[model samples]
Target: MKTIGRIKTNILSMGCFAVLLSFSSGCGKDDAEDTVENCFGGNWAERYAAELEVYANAVSVYNETPTPANCASYKTAAKNYLDALRSIVDCVPTISRAEINASINEAKAEVDREGCD
Candidate 1:
């Protein structure tokens, strides 16, 4: 009977420890769920910057080509990449859309001036 009592006490202690462990280890609610906009999960500016970097990379590839073979794929791919980037940037509302717009306009001008393959 005493051994049985000890077993019951051990079981209760284990249950309590499990509950405490879960609570202490952050098992209940996520920080994102607690917040409204989840700016931590990358805000509009962050997303825009990420997409813009891709655009810049595509442009770099398009610009560095000295031959038709190098120029062919990069130029075509740059257009598609730039289009997708612009769409993503446009979807996200910005505090200063003009800044992004100016940069895009500059890129457009460069593209037009180059007239590459």
Candidate 2:
């Protein structure tokens, strides 16, 4: 269906966006230090990357089967990915919390539309 295709496209786009954002690195030492300090003394990028991987895997599984259980798992993975992004909003000055929140809400809406809730 067209709706399903659109949902897949949107989810893939979000995943790609997150990947690109997570790879954005600070060019200077000061920026790097500030990122780590602001990111709860940890590597938020690394954490986000890990969550992204989990989300990607879930997407793959859901696409292959689309069972209710897999849908729930996919939703959980999505939440985790969004949570990781939310946790690092302050660390990455380039991306705003509003942007991340919008992505989260959009993803949730898409999932709900698919009856994945």
Candidate 3:
């Protein structure tokens, strides 16, 4: 049981780490300009940044407490972050789009495995 608990914790940690890594891998200036012109009326970057903050806060809360409610909140924040990232995929280069999609899908799987539902 202890080992299983550790494994779950590690999985969650990895998921959070992946989310953080994806957040860091943002678009370059040219891509950002394209994103601004194409997505959310030039506000996608700001929106994504805001969502990243919210997600970070949620992760901190979940880490501190590990409660079910906090877990649910974390999942919600993760989903929102994924959505924000997804919105600008097309505006980014193809390589970036593939990487972002992979991160999003991996994070989604992690959240699903969290079993908060």
What C-alpha lDDT values do all the predictions have?
0.40, 0.66, 0.62
For model 2, the stretches where C-alpha displacement exceeds 4 angstroms are: 1-12, 15-37, 40-42
State every prediction's TM-score relative to the real structure: 0.39, 0.65, 0.61
lDDT of 3 by residue, 14-54 (tens): 44544454456554444444544454443445646777778
Q: By lDDT, highest first, what's the ranking?
A: 2, 3, 1
TM-score (C-alpha, index-matched) for candidate 2: 0.65
Position 97, candidate 3: lDDT:
63
Model 1 vs. true fold: TM: 0.39
- After superposition, the stretches of candidate 3 with alpha carbons farther than 4 Å from their true spots are 1-44
lDDT of 2 at 116: 55
Please list the residue runs of candidate 1 whose C-alpha ends up more than 4 Å from where it truly belongs after superposition: 1-65, 115-117
lDDT for model 2, please: 0.66
The candidate, 1 or 2, that scores higher on TM-score is 2
Instruction: For model 2, give the 10-residue run with minimal summed lDDT.
Output: 25-34
Candidates sorted by TM-score, descending order? Answer: 2, 3, 1
Task: Report the C-alpha lDDT of model 1 over 44-92, residue by residue, as the tens digit.
Answer: 2332344445544554554464455544444444444445334433333
Residue pairs in collision within model 2:
none
- Residue 6 miss distance in model 3 (angstroms): 12
